[model samples]
Target: MTSFEELGLSAATLKAIAELGYEEPTPIQARTIRRMLDGADVIAQAQTGTGKTAAFALPIIERLDTRSHHPQALVLTPTRELAVQVAEAFQAYGKYHQIAILPVYGGQPIERQLRALSRGVQVVVGTPGRLLDHIRRGTLALDQVRTVVLDEADEMLDMGFIEDIEAILQETPSERQTALFSATMPQPIVDLARRYLRDPERIIVQTEQMTVPQIRQVYYEVGGRDKFEVLARVLDYESPSSAIIFCRTKSEVDALGQRLTARAFPAETLHGDMTQVQRDRVMARFRSGQAELLVATDVAARGLDVEHVSHVINYDIPLDPEIYVHRIGRTGRAGRSGTAITLVTPRERRLLKLIERSTGAPIQRLRVPTIADVIARRRESFKETLRETIAAGGLEPYVSIAEDLGEEYSPTDLAAAAFKLLLGEPPEDAEDLLAEQEPDTTEEEGGRRPRRRREQSFGPERGMTRLYLDVGRNDGVRPADIVGAIANEANIPGRAVGAIELFEHFSFVEVPSNLAERVVRALKRTTIRGRPIAPSLARPRRATGGARSGERR
Candidate 1:
């Protein structure tokens, strides 16, 4: 419950936090920021959605030396996705410092990043493997890096990045302050901390302090493809005075907005890519009651103050638990009761468990809104409208016309006709929306990885190319990390990935043969399993398999 202004941050940082609309620090933010500011190397055990990014990021930003271009801090993340997110946090928190925060990872154009590096940035956030690559290539200079953060350290160790991470740490100043944050500290992570972090202060930010007292947290387990229909059904059934739908990526926000528009919901999309003017217009519509639903990404949805919002639908579950708190916190505000429903794929069940454990609140499972439910909601809404209209008493001129119709029809028939005219025919659908719901089977699919499974598809008329990956299934690497990385960043269809095999040290996938080089080159530029991709041909399938066949003959 500590106020951010009372945390001894610089006036500039406090101003930025206020501008970002955060008046108080979450428990993790409050405890970690104070400890880190005191120059104590710290180990924090907290879940993802617990505002850990800002917990670490704000302290780093507050301490950064703006005049020097040399790296003052290096944050090593386990995945390119996380690297980007962390770097973004630095930029947001350090806005008042006029400091530069750069995200360098595999999959991005190295030359462009190198040019930026030469120009100078204050902080470098990277996957360990890519950071090591830059250190070796002389593209990055970290002689002044005073602070090092190993985020999601356990996942990094699982992915075989311990050696790479240790090497990166060695390159930084020995006098540096290091902070480590992880959900679970396995032996390797603990060992890494012991060797690198100097007399670290331990902080455990329990979720016990906070509760969503006015919010009803629920979820409907369903497949990704059926989410839109289910979302529509939920909207029709809930009939909130106003609502917001949270999406993970900008593309999702845009696509869902389009889909909702097509289905005739008064909705609009907002994301980082939109111009300020466009963002303004969307907010204007939502606030002025012209739009009923606001579909947005986390960045765009931050600090939204629409008080009438009765529900927040996480169209996609956030990557971390703190983000879940933030998303649902959008509703149940201003002393009003609110509802939050997350749509979960079965594979994310573990993630949900983690969230529940961290928050100490069990999320109730919800049945998908039925088609009959949608109709009932609409009928009720019309009834309310009818009551309001009668109260206003402005239909004197139309009374005789109704009477003329009443001559041809009985009271019941006339009333039914009037109901049809006003609210359309009541949809008599009896099917449960849950009937079509499919648990996201990607995680269980024998071949496809989770993130990449259903988000996209590649068509036929393609031959498969087998390529090597430096890390494998042993690293807790799922198909989704690979697929999400490829599809979103490489423009590769998620389905384009064919057979995959995860070995202890490496992995391989069958992609379109022609796209092999592109995939390898792209993957090399980003981190998967927390390090630079060391993609190289271990053995050509033709040569290895052909040689084996000849030996057998």
Candidate 2:
């Protein structure tokens, strides 16, 4: 179907889809939604981020009897994270239908769920365990359920929730329209579907169609701490008109969003933790060009159909290859060319190769943009702006000022000074730009020494304060681990972290003086290398002549 209008959806639903920026139905959505609305059992073999949620959700909402409010639909997921995400999708798509949707998961308080169930929700999206618990407590009734959806069925089978799923299905009416969605339909899933669904309509979205060919894929190998810096440089070089930056976790999204905003990138964040209103506001800002970059987690960015996105950046490479495909699929839509850039750490190169192998496409590796490259790009952009302004023929006032200065200086010199004034100072620390270059090896006593090694200093930088941690090299902690923990837990930018010095039983890390205490407090409640940490202000240590005993280089 070219448009949702052809799907026979109500006007209200079409309005909601329009406001959500959905231009057309995805392949999976196009094939599955019609059968679902026709009350046919469907078995769709599609991966996550394939618009599968909407494929089932839209039909469920259209067929729901909201007046009864006795759980007309039940959507089962393997993880609470996905349960919440799917529930949110139902809410977003069904908002016009005026139906109540409840998401029940184990980690949340049961009493709250009990009360919500008592209040009556038309749809219940939940993990099998919690849904079973509610069913056993006699608080949830599935007799009125007209639709049942098993989302990520293979994952549920992998998680050993197959029995719970069977039990939940047994509780629902056997005549209900059943829909099963899975990335891979293993034998168990197939058997379960055969036994539960009645003559299901099968739809398999091919692997070749999962990735968009219009996207130019590339990756840059960067250290974890240097990722933020590399990303900033890449953004400067690419200068995408609009971009969505995918982070692995919500905490990463928030931290990266803050860092991008601090650097004047005009970024917004979307994650599961934000309220619906907050998400709406963020999406509005992103779609309207008020925000140029959207730092988001996978679940939060799903079902988003904004067509103007010129780039999709994987700030943190996804662990799952399918997820990588989905992340990049956000761009290169509506017949527009797009770019997908990823930052890979040394340890993550294996994962990058795995993704390439799975996608059957080679991801070109490119060097991180140097400070000089960014400066040159800035100069070129300034020249383009100058040309445009001159073409507009509104330079009379500026010409008079140039004429006044022409007597004192040459025109070329005057233009050069103007260019310098407009383009601010170039980045300091040219040495840092060479950090990603292949290290030169030299013969040493042990074996070989890297010529371009990161400096190890115990003292903090001028604006930073040093903090000590109880766990270190002995606890199997690496510099990247330290940076990730601090950035994720403290909500600080990884680039803000200063020098890190690792010792046998301890380590010292630096943060901005203003955030030192906050980092310490946040670290106190967190763990590194599976061991709890005791973080505090670093105490003075005696100066040593050479490398400290048991210190890691």
Candidate 3:
């Protein structure tokens, strides 16, 4: 409701924001920025896409003393990805200030981070796990830190970093200004605030009042490998008037869009990576109906309220629940029921539960459409096209052509041929039109698949190292709980992790030999599944449960 300049932001910060083409301050920004500039400690209730990063980043950069190189601000995030994103925002807005910001997180080589720390920077944004490591190494100095932000505080709590967060807060100067933003203010978070923060201002941003009623919502639990296949079926069977598929990241949007187009779907992509002119061209075709399918990232799709959107397919489940609400709400506008289908990978079941709980809407599980269903839908569409033509009675001009074909071929054969022509199948490949169904692939018949960037194999095998976890299945810990924590903590890709065996008393997981040491150190510093993970190179000398020789039962 307020203008950006009215929030007391520096001229350079305002200039950069204006150049980004934003004028009005979002509800969260309007309330939070004014208080932050007023030197108030604040706790804000806002989601990922609600412009919280800018609300904090703008004020942090505005108050930055560019002449002083030491980090005056510390922004702690839940994930490395978020740290990178927030750091980028600081660097962008501070270009005019000539201020430098650095992001430190695990998985990234620490030497580089230490070097950056050695050459002091103006702002430091990092994850607690890695930030703690830096602090322990005596490379980062926060004695002079003026502003500290705990971004995504609830996520940090969920990630079991509450203790580390508290310790990090203790390390910063007590006089330092603190700003906290989270969607949910759980008891643990409130307790954290009460313990450390001065009387902080509170700002809340609620969901938008209106929704696109025309869009129908449906969800299906799926795996990562099967999403593309399912999405192809949705497009093939539904044949939306013009569809826009939303992905969470620019990389995903490009990859998914390219994959769909390679399979002969008339699709194009739009994302932050694209130039403004390229975006203009893609939208021009979409608005004019030439581009039947558009794959876009969330940044590219913001403010898109297209009336003719028949279906909005979420190929990659968004990380945030509100983003899900926004993605599906893209369709079913103007009082017409449109279809919104989301594909959730098994690992993202956590996100599914959160969305259902937050939106207060039941996410009906949908069954995957089989090949037969796809064919049925395609035939039904073809029949409607034929029937509509017949009812309109405008085919008299084509009667001669049909009569001539009927003389050489039976009416059934001619009709089948006509169906093939209408659907854009080649004449030679069209014989026996209703051929047995086989899974369609991105590979063209007789053509090679695009050579994917060969992910340097970790090799056919590698040394295996084991760790002793204090708890297992009995402690509400699953393989994923172990994997997500380590994958996030060690900065290891989930796919890189190997065998896991859990038992009543403890669990042991095999990780790549090279990262075994760091993984052990990280696990030792944190708890897994609410129980401390006492990881050591040597396995637990004694058996605690019924288990196999190599794995815990």
- Candidate with the greatest lDDT versus the true structure: 2
Minimum summed lDDT over a 10-residue window in model 2 is located at 448-457
| lDDT, residue 431, model 3 | 30
Candidate 1 Cα misplacement greater than 4 A, ranges:
204-210, 213-238, 242-309, 313-338, 341-357, 360-553
In model 2, which residue pairs have backbone atoms overlapping below 3 Å? none
**Which residue pairs collide, candidate 3?**
214-332, 214-336, 214-337, 214-338, 215-332, 216-338, 503-553
Name the candidate that leads on TM-score: 3
Candidate 2 residue lDDT tens string, 138-232: 99999999999999999899899999999999999889999999999899999999999999999999755345466799988766555666786
- Per-prediction TM-score, please? 0.54, 0.48, 0.56
The per-model lDDT (C-alpha) reads: 0.74, 0.78, 0.73
Estimate the overall C-alpha local distance difference test score of candidate 1: 0.74
Error of 1 at 228 (Å): 14
Off by over 4 Å in 2: 212-553
Across 1-553, the per-residue lDDT of candidate 1 in tens digits comes to 5788778899988865554435478888888999899889999998676778888898888888888988898999998867876786677677778998889899888998898898999899999878998999988877898899988888898899989998998888899999999989788888888888889988886555345556899988766555665676677678777889988677778767755553346778898789999999989988887788898887788877888888899888764566677788888888999999888775467567757866778899977765445656777888898899999999999999889888888889888877777544432322432243332334332322211101111212256656555565556776667677666666888988776655444455667866765886687678886865555433332111111111000
Clashes of each: 14, 0, 7
Q: Is candidate 2 or candidate 3 better by TM-score?
A: 3
